[model samples]
Target: MESDDLSSLSEKKLKKLINETQDVLDQLKAELKQRKLDRQHHEIDHMEDYFEDAEHNLSNLRLFIQKVFSEIRKR
Candidate 1:
């Protein structure tokens, strides 16, 4: 995706980029799920504490991937 011309990239390079992106996206999904569970546990335990972050992080992660893919496709 770094290249100005994606069509010029070899199949191997494109595949590698896709695989790496997938790994990162998977990690983000896992993090969001874990945070949601932690938040629930905190609510149940009557501790006014969770990770203390909005779900915006998860939302941004998806947006980020969308942007990256869009850029890749546009190239």
Candidate 2:
């Protein structure tokens, strides 16, 4: 009889531990998804800034080329 009681208590403890581990796993999954989304947003913003810098550089180059052509024509 004592052995039977011990078996029942051990089973209950195992079930409780399983439930706690599942809850923790679920929370970790949620946090991981959120972090991925945040990283994607950051990458998008970084790309936009890079494009903007390239556009500004192109505009300056165009102006410089025009000035050089004008000077050549005058000469």
Candidate 3:
């Protein structure tokens, strides 16, 4: 929140907003902890490998397109 917006709130409202924000933060931390305990390290690594392979494939495709365009320009 911007300081100007916060400054406009009454003290009681500000305190309430703070409490609500803390509750959300606590809930998010708990969810993340649960997710961490549930996922295996190897599964995450496999996802990363898939992303790397996709990136390599796209790079190769870009080069292939450039070569094809270069050949077309000679006609």
Candidate 4:
């Protein structure tokens, strides 16, 4: 509302408007926080997947190296 319009408001009416505005602000803040948390959770999930893949690749490499060493020893 314009400054002139706000000046005409009664104290009780202004108080009610302020309370409603505060409530809406609080809800928006909560939604923003939840979105941030969800993004962080998604990032953590991706990291876990990367770690699991790396672990599997390392295990396979270890077995291959051991087999190559065994063949070298036999020769």
Candidate 5:
């Protein structure tokens, strides 16, 4: 969702969104950790690029969630 749309949400809704976003971030981190463990067993080939992409996206998601929380705090 756009920042404008996010800014328009009610405080309760915004808090809920922040919680959901955090959950997603946690899942992504868990997935990355599992991928690293699986790599030790050679379960996947050429996964470095995939992991890098995931990390980048996860960083962006974290920033977005931070922005949402910042907005919530401003209310």
Candidate 6:
């Protein structure tokens, strides 16, 4: 959703969205951690690129989450 669309949501709905986004962020973090651990024990070709992509996506998600949070606080 766009920032404008998000800004239009009711406080209750916004809080729910925030919670859901947080859950997703948590899951991504766990997956990234696990991937790193697994890579350490096994030799996987081109695994570094996978990790880089995952980290990049995670960072974007985090920024989006932060924006949502800031919107919530504005209420």
Give me the overall lDDT of model 5. 0.89
Tell me which of candidates 1 and 4 scores higher on TM-score.
Answer: 4
Flag the better candidate by lDDT, 3 or 4. 4
Give residue 69's lDDT in candidate 6 (0 to 100).
100
lDDT of 5 by residue, 1-75 (tens): 899998899999999989999999999999999998988667457678678777688789899999999999999
How much lDDT does each candidate structure score? 0.85, 0.87, 0.89, 0.94, 0.89, 0.90
lDDT of 4 by residue, 1-75 (tens): 898999999999999999999999999999999999999999887997878777688789999999999999999
TM-score of each: 0.55, 0.49, 0.52, 0.62, 0.51, 0.53
Residue-level lDDT of model 1, residues 1-75, one tens digit each, is 445688888899889989999999999999999999999887878643434455358887998999999999998
Query: Which 10 residues in a row give candidate 1 its minimum summed lDDT?
Result: 47-56
Question: Lowest summed lDDT over 10 consecutive residues: which window, candidate 6?
Answer: 41-50
Tens-place lDDT digits, model 2, residues 1-75: 376765767777868877998999999999999999999998887997878777788789999999999999999
lDDT of residue 60 for candidate 2: 93
Write model 3 residue lDDT over 1-75, tens digit each, in one string. Answer: 899998999999999999999999999999998888667665776797878777788789999999999999999
State the lDDT at 61 in candidate 4.
Answer: 90
Off by over 4 Å in 2: 1-9, 50-75
**Global Cα lDDT for candidate 1:** 0.85
Off by over 4 Å in 5: 43-75
The residue pairs found clashing in candidate 4 are none
